[model samples]
Target: MLNLNDLRFFVQAVDCGGFTAAGRRLGAPKTTVSKRVAELETALGARLIHRTSRSFTLTEVGRDFYDHARAALIEAETAEAMVRRRQAEPSGTLRLTASVPTAQLYLADHLPALAEAYPKLHLVVEVTDRFVDLVQEGFDIALRSHFAPLPDSQLLQRPLAREDIVLIAAPAYLEKHGTPQWPQDLAVHAGLLTGPGATTWRLGGGDADEAVEVTPRPRMLADESVVLLKAAAAGLGITCLPEAMCRDELARGAVVRVLPGWTAGSVTTTLLMPHRRGQLPAVRAVVDFLCARLAR
Candidate 1:
């Protein structure tokens, strides 16, 4: 006979990456979680994971079992939720992840109101710019800005906003170097590109696209988008930033938009959720709130 409790622990362990992390998440001792998973494997007569010192990766059979187990567990929880919903109450901890700027300015700004609306919903937010593994991070939902839908099989995403990009340069830099008159002129001017890829930039003009390869003239290169913004603010070079991120700076004359008519619309913010059936009320409520807020 298979133990449902042990199956739950196995799912959590896989999601969390290691026994220690899974123990912390499940509030159980490492030995206990490890024993349960081991026992499960013994009963199933298959190796579920390939374990190493650094990480534990799922085997082919393990991956297949995890999918079915996750679905079955979620369905069981949903059945319980239906019973709880009959009593009319929403109570659970919601784990959410988002980039620093969006969490600080957009998500956290509106959360107080949502908390007021639903006092039972507890919000735990992880702010990071790095792409987090939803399952391994133990996040119920994440806010991401992607050019398209997420590629992960265990995640589902919904669109939230169509954010546009803008080219920004410090006023002094613009004055010294002179702003580019046309999209093609961007090639000559120094640029502070955000992420490394082929050292090429595509500037959008009305019904036309201009491709420019900008090689910065020996300056500090940063991987963080915020770093590029700060560098641009320090009059380093011209940088492309999301319009929403630099709106205040542009309004305050801290940074000026170089190409007004031309824009490369690439970024988009979306809400990503685990592909679980029994989503806690807190998670659903927050997702709904964000969609409504962004749509408005």
Candidate 2:
């Protein structure tokens, strides 16, 4: 087999004009450099150079080989430098997947700061409700929101935050239907629900907990929390959504929280990554950024 190192030496010898000069440039003995080139030629069964006492010249094959060898060496060096730079600083494309609501409500807003901090990092975000196979799908990280602890999986999960689910309704809806004083009052009002457990709202904080199963008379049934939020704000019905998702509307008084002292449930926001040794700096940077920002 032709040794890449030997090819490198041959290219350096050609570029430096002679074996002695190439040896000095490479910090190797002239005889050692000459011997490696001879081995490379022997491996390829071709005479790559013609030598004299004073100087060396390339054979017809040597000229063609030198051009290719020099280009290869340049490419190899460039690749090494790029990897080293990436190791030292976060620089590369990071692929992330998250639910549409989490992506739109949380990650979408915070990604700009991450980009600003790591200017060399490129982001490819995939937003979908479907659970993706990280290894098969080639995702670097995944952000998920779950009411229940995630089941066992090969992917590593880091809990980012426990987000409260607040019940909200448009002022018009609240005024016309009359505000619900208790969890049971939600049954008579139009309900905008999300996911399979839409009709089942487990409310309250401590021992005062109450489980209210409203009839599935949903005005809107969707997987995305944003859709449910918009429906609630449009006076379609009251819906329970992540507080983070409805913070703006709640502050603007576009939508008011129903049952102020109660919450439906809290979902744990988690960061998921494939288990691997030595995570890339870009991936580590994003993870740390999220943990810092979202944990607040």
Candidate 3:
């Protein structure tokens, strides 16, 4: 059980040739330096120094210990420097988790720029619809979109974007089933839904908010928004999705917004991290990147 500090003190004393000299160099008392070396000797159960009033000498054991101690101190210092450098610069692997749709549609496109900007950083992204425990899963960060305020948790969250949810369907589906002139007309149409929001479509903005109960049941049900979106794109049914996720599809006429004037509601996109303190440089960099770009 060698104390690293004691080893450092012993090495310094040996290098300086006396406790008094080592103390001056270390900004410590001479007696303190001598005591540390003594404690180090006691811990090793070996006398490391031969002392006289005139000068201090190293025993054979002391010389051997000095060599190893000096090398250890150098290695320890090198490791410290390396970590400090990493802290100053964004480098190393950043583990992030996000919903499948957001990852595929939004994050995928932005990753290239992030890579180019921080060449030292390597990103490992996990895409899943299920909420993951950031601490338990060892994730550096998580990107999540929620309509409601997130449940109380120890993790810190930063709002990245307020994403609007829009109902969309393929042109063929709209044409065959006939377009819904009002939100209630969605009850008769084949609805592609993800999870609990399957039958309940909340529309409008501000004080004019309205809830339309969908009927005839959902034609397709899936846990992933992307799956429901693909089903809607294939002309199976109408589905609601994030505007950002469907931007490309909408632009290319793959999917058209249903009930254009209405919305399912806006969800807050957030960046979740374990704590504000001691965040790795890479994690901080990615968080900043997403917040800046996504907000735009």
Candidate 4:
């Protein structure tokens, strides 16, 4: 007796922010979409949304029902996908997030192939430095780079890469300031530091690789590491950067390594997903694609 089509209309209406928008997306008339959602409300015997002349708001019960409704739709889609996947390619919109630097330096390069391989698949990427609640925010996946192990969470964590951090400065910068020969030599030099800023920078030294922490006087600071990369390349100051990102620059002599024996830091990039949603074909393809590409 449950009308899943009506349920779809209701969910799409909420997602699109209005029945008219949902109808546009669904290739149906606005009146039809609105009526379908109304029939769904009648079946449930609850006022799911409060409609206004220019807008609509989900009722308290509607908010809770919307969450369940989305999950049910996903389940239904997954069941059909299980059959189609054997003969067809994955196709759907996948919403994902990544830090600013990761998006620029890493993910942007890897995504093109996903598009090329799955022409029907659509990707929505959010480039941000802040951690987002995957379920609450409706993101399919998140790529994060962190120093410490991820905190306790229900989200499934997949380790991607542990990249070494290196010290880099433009040839012009060293020409002006002179090259630093030792870890302590960095004290007098300018630093293009990343945020949340580090009070003291830790450097590795000696054959046994002992740790040395130095307080950097920042010439410039930014929340994103890519910003510092630009600043460093412009001869603004020295900064810590992932070695993998420095490959092309290091090869072309655009930037030179400082204090060869010492390292600035390291980072681990991880993929996070909400529960069983990772099993969906489109989501799984992205996960697999990123894992394989980022590994290189």
Candidate 5:
């Protein structure tokens, strides 16, 4: 294996003008520094220095080699610094926000580990679907679910999950109401819809350029996803939810997907943070932790 100490020794020798000077700075004997540099040249099968009694100079290849060796040392030092920075225990309040569906399906799963790892780091999480301004709202970071590109802003975005919005209903509901074979048939079933009041549902899929819309005439309406999920599982009516959020329900037969090839579009879960917040160790720790676990 190539020794990193050789790279350090070689770089120091070149910068300090000679092995004797490099050794004084590195707290090693001049002979040891000279030996390490020779080993490096031997490993590469090329001479890196023209040595003499009075002074040493780099050969043509040695000059080129020195540039790369210096660059490598800088990169190695930077990598070590970054690892040390991340290892620093981050402490401070980290204010965060996310849509309800994203919190339940993705963020909730990984946040516990982050909290446990950095007990000194406090978290204040807001769950909502509103488009919150990170700067104006004083939020350090936010998680958002977007169907389209977010409006251009100063915040930075990192994707956490790409969730397909699937329609689901209880088996009892499907058997009693009969499965909808097409998008138009969706109108006939009782709809347990999200958001307040009644509105048309638009689904996009099935090898089509255009989306399909239907007015199911919702018999129940609410803004909460868990409420809708529970209602659908209780044989109330068909509703839309992220497929990942419905995993347990689908597995337990509490709910089954409907309209296999069709979907209520897709949602991208993203982490957003202000540009200034990126420099904070607390924010960096939380962002790194979430990205490591939640990124898909």
Candidate 6:
């Protein structure tokens, strides 16, 4: 019989890129993880890993087995989530990460309610614009906005909110440079762009996605969404930002929307967590709280 725990260790080893890394994630000694893998391979009479002094690579047979092992783990996790769903309450430490603005605007306002509802739940929030390694960073959940879908299946994602990227500028800048009527006019105007994916922004209407390449003058190139927003508000440059990020500013007339007809769609927020079985009560609680709060 295949030991599921050993299979999990194998998957972790592959994901973390080494036996020592897998051991750290599983909180086991490196030798223990190594021995369990060796034992599993011996029982099956097959070589699963192509090991070297510096690295480990999977063989064809190892890849095949990994697929099955990964599926089994996902199913087990789903089952455990079902069980946690039946319980009326949640408790424990919930480590979470999010962009600085989202944390300030959404989570900071909402997480207290969740914590209050579940007194035993302790919430730790890490706010940053940079990508975080969830497992390595010891985070239970992360909230992010991306133009593209997260490409990894090893992390389960739950969509929290649907948002749109709207062109924003101070009334002064629009008056000075004249507002851009179409995507093409953006080339002539001073603009701000978010950096993460590629530097290109997809701008268009309906189902036909149009890619427009713009070279914006950078007083400073901001990697952080909040900083980008502040620059736009100060009338430094026009920017396309998530609607959620600029809601308060738009409402207050600090920044006004431009190019209503020609808009870009790059706004999506999701809760991401490690694809694991038997998440404890506190983790599940934080997930539910975030889903509900963001949904609203």
The top-ranked prediction according to lDDT is: 4
Model 6 residue 94 CA deviation in Å: 5.7
Using lDDT, rank the candidates from best to worst. 4, 5, 2, 3, 1, 6
Question: lDDT by residue for model 3 over 67-130, one digit each (tens)?
Answer: 7886677567556646966566677777889987668765887989999988888888899888
Poorest lDDT segment (10 consecutive residues) of candidate 1: 211-220
TM-score versus the correct structure, for each prediction: 0.79, 0.67, 0.66, 0.77, 0.66, 0.66
How do the residues 47-124 of candidate 4 rate in per-residue lDDT, one tens digit apiece? 999998977999999999998998888898789878878878988789999988778777888788879988988889
Evaluated with TM-score, which candidate comes out highest? Answer: 1
- Please give the lDDT score for candidate 3: 0.81
Relative to the true structure, candidate 4 reaches a TM of 0.77
Q: Where does candidate 4 stray beyond 4 Å?
A: 12-34, 46-64, 124-139, 147-154, 175-178, 195-199, 204-211, 222-227
**lDDT against the true structure, each candidate:** 0.78, 0.81, 0.81, 0.85, 0.84, 0.77
Q: Write model 5 residue lDDT over 178-290, tens digit each, in one string.
A: 99988899888989887664467798888878998888868799877889899999999999988887889999999999998999988888889877566667787888888
Residue 133 CA error for candidate 1 (Å)? Answer: 1.9
The sequence of per-residue lDDT tens digits that candidate 6 reaches over residues 1-296 is 88888888888887788899889878999998898888889888999999999879999999999888877876776666567657745655568899877687668888778878888667788898788988656677888866688787678888888788888998888887788776767767776766644345567673445666555554446677888899899888788887888989999999998877656776677788886622655676677777777777
Shift in Å, residue 161, candidate 3: 1.6
Model 2 per-residue lDDT at 56: 88
Residue 103 displacement (Å), model 3: 1.8
Clashing residue pairs in candidate 6 are: none
Between the candidate structures 2 and 3, which one is better when assessed by TM-score?
Answer: 2
Residue 107 Cα positional deviation in candidate 3, in Å, after optimal superposition: 1.8
